[model samples]
Target: WAYPMQPIQSAAMSGIGYSPIGPVEGTWVVGFFRDGENAQDPVMLGTIGGIPQNFPGSDGFNDPNQVYPLSNLNFHGLGEPDTNRLARTIGTDILGRDSKEHPVVTQKLSTTPLFDESTGTPIPYPGVPIESEGGDIRRIPKALAEGNFWVEPPTDAPFTP
Candidate 1:
């Protein structure tokens, strides 16, 4: 197992306050070996995001399990750079080139086959006051009551939603 170096932001003081690094399988990471020359013990600095050149395969130098780069009915993010769209909005980027802003959540949710016209897939979600933290898009209170909101259903859900 690799030893992950904690960031300066993280409080790695006591045993009480420790957070695990979350670099998952198929995630390309930048790291070095603790026992120099011997690649037995890895010291992971962080993961890197980049444009995937090819689909994963069950060979060396790539996803050996071939688990990642999963495809949906339409979306297969191969070749596309993994820049977080929210990070750079129109007029906010360092480059002077003007880029379009992300559409409202309630608008046409997805272009892929997962786009559901019913619940307006990827509907308006709640936001938090704190900006530094990251979280998932959540539904507004009693949003389902408004009707036509069934979206990507949970596996346990009996009916489609």
Candidate 2:
């Protein structure tokens, strides 16, 4: 889903001058995958736009016309697994596009095949284990207390959140 940022303000010194603010106009792709999921490796789950090329008032502030790669911005403040929630919530910032608010305009992208299509068999990635179910993988809290199961967080950075 692409978040398109609009120019909100213009330079104070010159009314016609550029705003020199907000995210650039372009496309960005965000992906999520199971540690070893095959068939659909590196799933194309979503896209976002209006990502800031640079923070306001920072170095390179004068060059509003220059476009930078979206990957350079701070994805670190995203916090944790719940970062997804934040990204969805903050649909349009002073800079980036938020996914939660603009479902239609954001444009959801996916790599999964259509169910009715008759194509080649799904191939699993080498050495990747497939989970039997396709749903929330969290263990039931009650089940754990009853000694029916145990749950632990994956040490892997990507899976932890």
Candidate 3:
């Protein structure tokens, strides 16, 4: 789920659950993963998007204010069974982030595997290089493996256009 990290554009946009930290819009953000002492490899979950919803206003506006979904939301990651190391890592990485900044949500499955299609298993971990269609290729990190991550939206999440 390697998403493009972008820079915040304004003072009004400089808080938790805000937009990303770069110039690209809605780039794929990645959540790293590991197995025991070894970094298992990261997974390509999905892109982050904004969602809009209504909220009650305290200033006596009478009508609820239109707010982004992630503005007041908090997300918790679910750990898979039978793995103590996995549980610990999940707790530290996913739960450790500020809910206002990094909201948690379910990770979506990718249609394409990060490894070579001819081989069902992953390509070489940590150092194997991958070539893409647009002449862009590089060695992927070991933190990106199958089945080890999730994503969540913000409370005041905006509508991604």
Candidate 4:
């Protein structure tokens, strides 16, 4: 049996509160065996992440139920990492995004925002922080522009709210 490690954030109590999930299929983990020479009891330390270039195989060590790296023509965020780009500290500033990265973050926020055809929600845009001084997002931004930025249906979409 494989023994998995948990982060300090996990309470590790009676199977409740903040537990690190065990690695799923296709996840690359690094670890060692507790039994040393026995090499039977593997201890999974952590998972390795990267841009998944290839799809999972049919046999082993891969996702069995679904195909991965879905066709770019069929899906968005194909080459993106597990964590959203806007959530990563790539450039200096708010929402982990800066004006410096071309075509990645803020640049696309204004110039060309991709919207959801069904919901009209801008898919490419990140949920901007609402606070004035530092953009804290805890409270909603009361005084901001509001309108249908996407398309024009015959009447308002069913999701108008």
lDDT of each: 0.37, 0.28, 0.29, 0.38
Candidate 4: worst-modelled 10 consecutive residues by lDDT = 131-140
**After superposing candidate 2, which stretches have Cα over 4 Å from the reference?**
1-27, 36-40, 51-161
Backbone clashes in model 2: 4
State how far residue 146 of model 1 sits from its true place (Å).
Answer: 38
Clashing pairs in 4: none
- The model with the greatest lDDT is 4
By TM-score, the better pick of 1 and 3 is 1
By TM-score, the candidates rank as 1, 4, 2, 3
Per-candidate TM equals 0.41, 0.16, 0.15, 0.36
lDDT of 1 by residue, 81-123 (tens): 4332222121112111122223123332222333347876753
Candidate 1 has a TM-score of 0.41
**78 Cα displacement, candidate 4 (Å):** 4.1
- Kindly list the per-residue Cα lDDT of model 4 for residues 67-138, writing each as its tens digit: 433333212223554332223422233232233232122222233577899998876444332211112111
Model 1: per-residue Cα lDDT at residue 134 = 16
Decide which is better by lDDT, 1 or 3.
1
User: What's the true lDDT of residue 131 in model 3?
Assistant: 19
Where is the poorest 10-residue window by lDDT in model 1? Answer: 127-136
Off by over 4 Å in 3: 1-80, 84-96, 99-103, 106-111, 115-140, 143-161
